[model samples]
Target: MDKRPSVLVIGDLMLDRYITGTASRLSPEAPVPVILYQSNEDRPGGAANVALNLVAMGCDVTLVGVIGEDAEGELLLSLLLSPHIDTSNIEADSQRPTTSKTRIMAGAHQVARVDREIASDVWEHHAHTFLRLVRKMLRPESIGGHPFDAVVFSDYAKGVVTEDLVRKAVENARFCGEDGIPVIVDPKRKDFRAYKGATLITPNVAEIQLATGKSVGSNEEASTVAQDVAERYECSVLLTRSEKGMLLCDKENGLKTMLITSRPVSVSDVSGAGDTVVAAVAAGLARGLDLEAACRHAEVAAEIAVSKPGTSIVTEAEIIKREAAA
Candidate 1:
């Protein structure tokens, strides 16, 4: 923990804008309640949020992804370009606007959400720039070692994460050492195979069901499904079950899978909780912690994340404070 672990984050990056206020009147044109706009706050979202989470964990972070040639993109950069984070690899796409999600909150309740993005494959728009940067990061220098201690593939199913990218990143990353650094993936794509060779993949109940068409109604069933998927994909599985906590069926542990139960708390919102888990786990690994230890710590971090509203951040100090209190 003395040194900051360098982490590379590659995936779809975006901005999250929150509009919080009180709503008392119904809209004259529609039946929905009208929300009188109060104040708006913008934060890094998607993969950008992952970078933020890592930086909060005291990691030296580098972000690589596509952004729009727009004001929103500029705002995102301003928020994320910090002393702890390197944003040099992030590229801009003129054809598409920056991906942004605007959420309207009526006090504690979410009234509505508006998203601005092009959901298609963005390879045509940013492949050349992305591939070049990725390869550069992956390439080994003859000096000390690889720049990163961990690599995170935060796939939002946007055009950024590709099958080719995954393979190449892992392939070139082996130069870090004989064992190579841990490759952690926060997968959103239905087909789990695209994230093959990752050290671990964090998926929730719905993602599990969609990827393998299996029922996760029970703990035993969920474990079986997770083990199968992990085996099929040739990586470990860290299954995040909202209230039930998380299940870790790691390939590194053979047939052993540990399910860490969630601590009882008031759940606010589940959005971006998985990102916290990914960041915590990757940070733990970068700091020389094993996957099991990483996941246990990540569970604590995620529990903290869900207790707060919106795509908020969880820091190492906060997590340490929480553990001390516990």
Candidate 2:
């Protein structure tokens, strides 16, 4: 862990816009709260937020995804550029507008949201360019003869993370000689098989149920379903169970599930906590922590992330501080 661990992030990227104002009365046209126009703000969302988390934890990140040929894309690119984050692989497609969610907040509550996006696979040229970039990064001689330590697939189901694309990416990353790069998935796809050759999959209770068609209301149920998905998909499972902590099961450890308990705190908005969890796990693996240890680190990172208001960044120092107190 002497040098910075370089990580590659690929998936769906979106822009989160918020327009907050005061609400005094209900709208006459419809049964909705009337929000007085105040101000507008935008933030990098989805996979972009995952990149933010990785860079905050001191990892060098290369972000790959598709955006729109619009001003929102321009603003998102500006927000994503940093000393540690390389946004060169992010493509801007003219076929669709940038995926964006604009929430109208009345005082402290969100009244309504407007989303603009097209849910479809990446266009042919975009897909080819993405594959080329993936291949380039996998090569040891690509940039400074340094291959990525880990790859994070932060899927938001916005059509960027296609099955064929994931298959090719996983194949290349898993077979690049003896020291294979780890591919971690923060999956939004209902089929876990789409990420068959991945090293780890981070799914919450809701996702676990949908992916496996099972009811996971209790810890035991979650364990059963998690194992089913892990073994079936040929990948390890890092099930994030919110207040119940996390469960880690993998073939490397004989599928012995370990529950990494969540440190209880005052819960705020859990908007982008998953992005932080995936970023922390990828960064932890890059820094040489085993799966269980890395998951423990993610538990602490997510705890800190959820305690803050809306989607917020947690720094390496903050995580270290929280761990020391624990």
Best by lDDT: 1
> For candidate 1, what is the TM-score?
0.96
lDDT score for residue 212 of model 2: 85
* Alpha carbon lDDT at 248, candidate 2: 89
lDDT of 1 by residue, 140-257 (tens): 6664457889999999987899888888887777676667888999999889988888889999899989999999989999999998988898899999999899999989878578
How high is each candidate's TM-score? 0.96, 0.95
Root-mean-square deviation of candidate 1 = 1.5
Please write out the lDDT profile of model 2 over residues 1-326, one tens digit for every residue: 47889999999998989898999988899988788889888888899999999999999999999999999999999998799998988888988999999988886577788999998888988888888887777765433343688999989999888777778778878655466778999998777889997899999989988888899787788788888887888889999988889998875887778889987798876878999999999999999899999999999999998998666788999999999999
TM-score of model number 2: 0.95
Superposed model 2: Cα runs more than 4 Å off = 140-146
- Report the number of clashing residue pairs per model: 1, 0
Model 1 lDDT, full chain set: 0.89
